[model samples]
Target: MAIDKEKIKQAIRLFLEGIGEDPDREGLKETPDRIARMWEEFDRQREFNFKLFEEFGDYNEMVIVKDIRFYSLCEHHLLPFFGKVHIAYIPDKVVCGLSKLVRTVKAFSLRPQVQERLTQQIADFLQEQLNPKGVAVVIEAEHLCMSMRGVMTPGHITVTSALRGIFLKDLRTREEFLKLIGKQGL
Candidate 1:
């Protein structure tokens, strides 16, 4: 379902008013519309198609796309969590466009998600669609929930990774991937 921008604008107006800000003031007048536009764009994930993974055949080497940047809201605090995602797959009979992999990551990251589950979802989708020999996803993020609230640990980063098939079975292959992403570069 499409998000109603007008409804969000109304809510933003009420939010500003609730915070004792004058919504009609010049600086705040357009804030509601701007916020509505931002959220409308954020909710565009429902429009992506993941069938792009079906375009390649029987190629069995690891494919990796590293450091795709994304931003999302934390479900617990409803604040921003920005991060980078790295994805890899070993194709058995199908492969996807490099941009499609980025888009797939964006589709999920745009929603409120826990880092670990999001990593697994990306790996699982690629594994299911490509039936690859293996799939891997790594995500590193900084959550406002911790940095702006709670214990307020500013420099800490959270890392989550998911591995399937050969990546799960072979330590060397997993190590290679971890090294390539600069976890233990050699």
Candidate 2:
């Protein structure tokens, strides 16, 4: 669904007033418009436009794209959670361009999200799109909601992973994926 920019602007103005800040103040007058525009940017969907290719010389090994940086707003508190995502998939008979993995992470992460769900969504999308033998996605993020409030522990990162198919059933495969992503194997 399309986002309503006007409604967002109005809501931001109301939020500013509710927080006891004057919406018309010199510094704050444009804050509402800026916030609305930020959401609009997130609302625009960028096409993946990636095509899968047939097997290349009988090559069928794990393809990995790691350290893909992403920034997303938390669904719980609307706070920022910025992170890196690592994706790996064992193609069955087809493989797409490596950059497609990075694009997949970006496509799923630009929306309001939780790290756990974001991890799974990437894995699931890859599994469906590539029909891979397995898919693994790992995310490490620092949440402003946790760092700026509550326990207020800054610099603490939350790690989440999703494993599917062969990655779940094969210990060696899972271990290899974790090791390559700079995490110790279980």
Candidate 3:
């Protein structure tokens, strides 16, 4: 679905007025337009393609891509949350390009999201596209809504994980994934 940029601009203007900021002020006049443009860029994930997955016949092992940095807006508060995602999958007959994992994370993270759902979406997408024997996704993030407001506890991080197939059933497979990703504490 296409975003209504004009509606967003209007809402931002109203929000500025509600917050007692002069939307017509010299410095703030274009703020709404700028925010709308920023949203356009942030929402580009809506256009992402998953056809990048490629089939491979010989290699079948755990493919680990770790420490992929991402930025997202919290759906609850519209505040920023930034994080690193670790992805691991045991291939069956197909393996995706390494960069495709990063792109998948980017596509999901670009939307307003919670870290937990974002982690699952990446794992689920990989599972569906690559038909991997198993998939594991871990996300560690700091939400501005938490640190900048609510508890006001800075440096607090939230970690979430999603495990599928063998990662959920095999203790050793899961352990190896966690240890390799440096998330053994999970």
Candidate 4:
């Protein structure tokens, strides 16, 4: 769905007013509109373009996409959590295009999310979409909520992972996946 720019701008104006800023001031007049556009882009995760998943043929292998950068909001403090996501799936009959994996990560990581749930969601989606033999997802992130406010572990990275099917049942398969992602023996 397309974004309602005017409505988002009005919400931003209300936010500015609540924060004791004059939205009508010269410098602040365009702030609402700009913020609205930013939010529209940030919420792109709500929409999914399934057409991007249609390009894979019969190739069956462990498809791994690593170091995909993303930025998301923490649901608790509404602060930013920036991170890299690594995904690997052992395909069955259908395989997804390599770039589609990145798109999948972006599609979910663009909104309010928790690293743990986000990791699982990506793994689940790959399982559902491709019916893969197994799926693995890992995320490493630094949250502004934790670094700038709570606990304040500045520069400390939080990691989360989700493993399904063979990735969960077979230790060797899981270890191989971890090694491929360069997180083995950690």
The numbered model that scores best in lDDT is 3
Q: List, residue by residue over 1-186, the lDDT tens digit for candidate 3.
A: 777899999999999999999999999999999998988887786555565334465677899999999999999999999989999999887777788888899888987898888988888988898888899999999999999999988898899999999999999999999999987857
**Local distance difference test scores for all models:** 0.84, 0.87, 0.89, 0.84
Question: In model 1, which range of ten residues has the least summed lDDT?
Answer: 46-55
User: What order do candidates take by TM-score, descending?
Assistant: 3, 2, 1, 4
Estimate, for each residue in 1-186, the C-alpha lDDT of model 4 and write its tens digit: 677899988888998899999999999999988977887876675566554343464666688888999888898887999989989988776777777788888888877788888998888888888788999998999999989897977898999999999889999988988899899974
Deviation (Å) of 159 in candidate 1? 0.5
In candidate 2, which residue ranges exceed 4 Å CA deviation? 55-57
TM-score of 4: 0.87
How many steric overlaps are in each model, in order? Answer: 1, 0, 0, 0
Give every collision pair in model 1.
58-93
Candidate 3 wrong stretches, greater than 4 Å:
52-55
RMSD versus native structure for model 4: 2.4
- For candidate 2, give the lDDT: 0.87
Model 1, span 84-155: residue lDDT tens: 998888888777788888888887778778887888888888788777889889899999899989988777
Order of the predicted models by lDDT, top scorer first: 3, 2, 4, 1
TM for every model, in the order presented, reads 0.88, 0.93, 0.94, 0.87
Displacement of residue 45 (Cα, Å) in model 2 is 3.9
Per-residue lDDT for 102-176 in model 2, tens only?
788778888889999999998888899988899998899999999998889899999998999999999999999
Q: Pick by TM-score: which candidate is best?
A: 3
